[model samples]
Target: MFQNQHTFHIPVMGTGHSIDTPIRVAHLGIHSVISVVDDLLCEKIRKHYCSEFDLAYKNIPRSAVDGRAERIKAYLETVHEIVTRKFQEIKELPLFEGNEKDRYFNLLPGSNPLKSAYQFIEHLSDREMRERLIEDLNNKMRPGSIDVNIMAKVDALGTDKDDQPLSSEYSDASAALRGYANSSLSSSLVLSAGFNPRLYSYISDFKDFYRDTSGEIKKKVILKVSDFRSALIQGKFLAKKGIEVAEFRIESGLNCGGHAFASDGSLLPVLLEEFREKRDQLRETFLPMVQSFYEAQGWEYPEVSDEQQSPRITVQGGIGTNGEMERLLTEYGMDATGWGSPFLLVPEATCVDDFTSQLLANAAEKDLYLSGVSPLGVPFNNIRGSGSAIHTEELIKKGKPGSKCPKGFLVSNTEFTENPICTASAEYQILKINSIDESADTEEEKERQKNKVMEKTCLCTNLGTGSLIRLGIMKPTYGRQAICPGPNIAWFNREYSLDEMVNHIYGRGESLVPEERPHMFAKELVMYVDYISELSLLTDPGDAEWKKLVRMQKNLEKGMDLCMEIAESEAYEGENLESLRLTVEKQRMRLADIFQNNLVL
Candidate 1:
């Protein structure tokens, strides 16, 4: 982490968007996360890169024993090899323009001490001294960390070729973990989506997760959480098994891409405040338990140092400008920030096919929306006019909705079927629609219910379709490319080079978004208000649901008041603090309306 030259990292965008990001950016000393959620996608990408590099390509059949783990391991090793090769090439190159070496240095923040030291060495008078410094700088250069992400909830149980249930270790998430665990790269595993008790407990079997007598951890675990409570619970679980959490990556609940795990009206600032106050509790609560576990195994646990005890805290979501990032880092004391959606526009960073890339560029605020298309029943942040959306709509028009369910990684439904199936599968949807039509509900209610049933799209296969198209493994004609970008994608309207985007993030170049775009905090507040309004209108809440709504209202007011204080206090140059002030007042009135007309008082 100290060696990472960049203060921000590219988070896992989707199963495919950033699957190969490490191969693209790691050589530049920029850390990024790859989604290992789709091993088949990773395998295809592996074969593609292997052919490009003239490396041997062997097919690992899905029916082979523990093939999912092996496939992921081989692909990740290939990515690590490619990234190392590129970094060595960059190190060997002389300081020159019109080359990757200059691109790497120029992409770094000018305020970075390494960049400053490199700049200073170029102007030195003594030739021998200058050469020595340059050599030292080159030697100190390190490739960025190649982190992998596993959505814990995506761990659907797997079956063998005989259609019999396999052991829990062969589940989707478990296999991905085993692959990453056995990989040659020494990196971190980011556990996102949600916690799986089995997955957390299984991590104990890997010896790399434990610390040795010498101060070296081959593999560290990072938990991507939405709130402090979740962080504590998940961290404590991992700690009980002798696994120390390397970092806690906090994401904005409603303002992120993919599945928007909206907290119960918990705002980003409020969550960050809780983490900031209780950051030490993570180390305090877990250390003794972890030490005891190590002792039971007859392994010496490293003496805890104040500096090494606490896990690193990072924040990401809806951050489109440098001013917001500066506030997150300086004000909240975040160790790092994650820039995700904006990187989707950087072809040099993310893998978006030409057609999908154009769709992302032309996407307006209205085009990027919170959709209910995910088969997992979570609110998915989606874009309008994506190939998958278009395909789904066309299928409905033809009276044949739902996919054929090729790769059933998301299968969880048991309704109307003996065996579990994906709700988005044709067989399931047809049966569900039949049941909805015969119900005694009114026409309007039936239509609404049917819409909900049909809204589930085949995300398992479609999510990675764009990457296949972009990588030339699949044709664009078979376009069913699904993209899940946060609302921030609406502000970035064009493809950008990797260097240009990094320059924007560091505030070294002109801003990519419009000046009128609201501050990240302001946008989040507005979204929460809108989300509450939507929830209130969903139905007349029962006592239980009504109580939840009331709690949300109170929590929202707390966040609004805090935003008001920040707005009245210090106004950042381009942070649009005034808009935040306006949003607070505007949402107050809307919140009043929800209480008055929608939800019960």
Candidate 2:
């Protein structure tokens, strides 16, 4: 039950990149999340870690009863053991320069008690006193939480060998939750993507989620939210079930790395402002309901102060610099921050393959785009020339557009088949394309419709191929490797060591990114303006979509005004305010022209 000593946690990247991140960074007291979307991939990586650590490995076949859950459970337990073993070794090392033992403390924030103690005793002359302090520091030192992420809405219902659908309990998210619940690791479970009432209710079945007699929660719940409303609603739902959310990790809607959940034009700074004002509402509103549930269940609730308790508000997505981290922590009152996409450039931290890593390091801002490649139909943050994209385009040129559908984890389409099939699958694409061709539509429109159908790539397999390649579990040409990096990856142009990346986050030595790089807040404004402009082009005025666009326009204006105030306020040393002021004014004029044109409509 160790806590994260660092100020930032590494958010879960695509299905593959950060899958084994905890093993790479957790022992250094750095928090990182693993995605359990693909149990087959998890099973393979479990074997790799076991072989590397010289631990026992028993294969969990996909056909076994509750095998998906069982594989995830086994993998998580293995990670827990390895991280614990690694942390103990780090603690045993003497505090010497350039050693991991020193790195562990040096990685922590300047204000941390453990780090302060280590800094105090590292140069002490008295051998006995120094030895006593070192032992005390070891006792107090904690490894970061080995947290796991479950894309809540990606809970595809499973089918047996005969193609009979299984019960709700055997669904993807439920089984993943069961795996984490059964694992020995005591950490938070980040339920992201969106809400699944079934998944949230399924959480009540695990006693580890509830507080014990000692008032300590073994397994914590972290609802990955986009805004305050989602956080409030989801938090209430869990609270009524006697489950208090440990954190509401707000991610940017369109500015994030994975499936972009573009809200009705609401921006990140605006969302952070909402959480800042109503963070207490999260505690006050949920507490009474949580206490009532505990009372009804005949369980004793902890008498914790409202000032200090569960439901810490944290924000992530597109954070690039230490000044930005400081603003999030100090200005917005965020408990901690999550740094995700940048870590993909750090080989000592992520599981990116060599070929893919080169592409990411050399990628430019124009190369990173919001693409229509997700089988889920959400706008995915994609790179321009990924192996998967190239492979898909080649298939189209050969007059065969669609994937072979290897894993079938994201099979949610029912456009043609009675049983749901993935849009990325050959069967669905073939049926869809044939129907479009036969329709009485114009040739240009038909081509557009057909192109949309072929945009779906089999992410279930492609996303995990990078990890398999890096671990030597699969060859480079096994599958077309797909990578999803945020636009921030454009600023970071090379692979960084673990110590170097941590130093960048803390603003210790020279900055890793170029000095001309825009502040995280300013960069978000540019992204939002660009995103809203795209929305205006796609929607006609006075329609349902256009009404949403109108709301977005107002929100953007308010958000921009807030950004202006931030630029005008007391500046943090490296905040880069000039870029923000210039960007805001430029985007403001662009917004005016868009509004004027819409008025003509």
Candidate 3:
């Protein structure tokens, strides 16, 4: 019936020959399966995931529901029946190859319930039924069916208020239900040891159960040890306990919760050094074991300023600033970057190669203007520079009036935020109109022109706040199933639906919250930037650019100083600093329109 069916090859972007590093892009395209730490949460997420996958499930036969163990056993039988039927058919199919079949076969024994199902299926007397089931199962199992690594949250682990591991001991009905699923499900449960550091105290018992009880099953676990040194020490302890740790997450940079900027540019050096040292030591202790690491990239206020700097530039301590990820990939040969922000702003951002060419061009422009320094790494350049470029592309796509971005992309930022480019472009056009041969003494005309342009572009409102409510930017959704720092503009850019972002944003265990006032978060983020700027200036007193940054920050802190009057008289407003800056952004955009082509030169 499905004769015409062919494997749908979603052309993976950012591969080897393309512009950006291929491996990083490839890692993103792969499916990531996750389990919530809370039992109730897990059930909700599981049901949604199952629906997405179209996995077929059956109720236990009426005769099999007399007891808890029997009920559990019946579930195992059903899952086994489902998996076995699928695998047998897959094996006989033309697609069957060496490891291709391996991925489709078997179940871990131990506390894992799938093994029992496998064993029960093994005893079936009807070979014809088995073969038929196998064929049917393969057709149903499908290739992309089990791609995600099974994940579990640590906060949801161990005993409830009564001190009992939810899976091992069931004091509550919710725990009981989850434990049943854990036992029957074929996917490995990722024990997030990092979230619940206290769980490490009980790692021995948990490891024993997985190793001894489910000896035949693949007992892989993701140990989320974020602290670099602590992870190394705990990793050793985990190894001794016989648990196979899959990946480690390093949470060393930026206050993504408050979504605040960092005091250090990226502060990655501190953690990267530790990661390198630990990985080297770890290899000596566990040579053949699979070693994995993820660099946490969360949120920060987009840095927009009048510094004539580069966008996407890596400053001293900023996260997601440098080619650190690329460097790390080549240097340590790591697995993933745990990058969530850049993708949040651009959902189809998985293909890095397509964008890398443009990024290189943008980087080059900044490099030339900033005297060989990349724009992306500049102090306050990122916020508007990156947003403006992205916004420009989105605007053109919407058929809005604006010049193309510097890279000739779009002009809306709607791909990630509102059409800041349109606003900027319009304001700049007005400014030019007012100039009128310069000898006309038209400063009043220019001011009027700028005001008219600002109102038309919605530059008067807080773009960031509007983005949060209107577009669900920097928010989390139920389906995305990832918790990130609050009102996350980066995640919003990643193409996450408003509904999905909202779910994760307000969902249980989320750490970020709005301040009940506009620009509250922005102010906090600015303070962090100020702290970092001051520190950098102190350390590198001789840095001319840094001195300029300190001057700019002080002006921004005091609601604008002498420069504000020179740029525009009405730039300073007591309340809503972001609102005042909106005008400044429009002015900058206007300047770009008049001079962008020749401006960098």
Residue pairs in candidate 2 whose N, alpha carbon or C atoms collide under 3 angstroms = none
Better of 2 and 3 by TM-score: 2
lDDT of each: 0.88, 0.88, 0.32
Give candidate 2 regions above 4 Å deviation.
305-308
- Tens digits of per-residue lDDT for model 3, 6-37: 11111111101111111112211112222221
For model 3 the TM-score comes to 0.35
Candidate 2 lDDT (Cα, whole model)? 0.88
The TM-score, computed over Cα atoms with residue i paired to residue i, of candidate 1 is 0.98
- Model 3 scores a C-alpha lDDT of 0.32
Q: Show where candidate 1 strays beyond 4 Å.
A: 96-98, 599-601
Off by over 4 Å in 3: 1-33, 44-181, 184-198, 201-217, 255-266, 283-324, 342-601
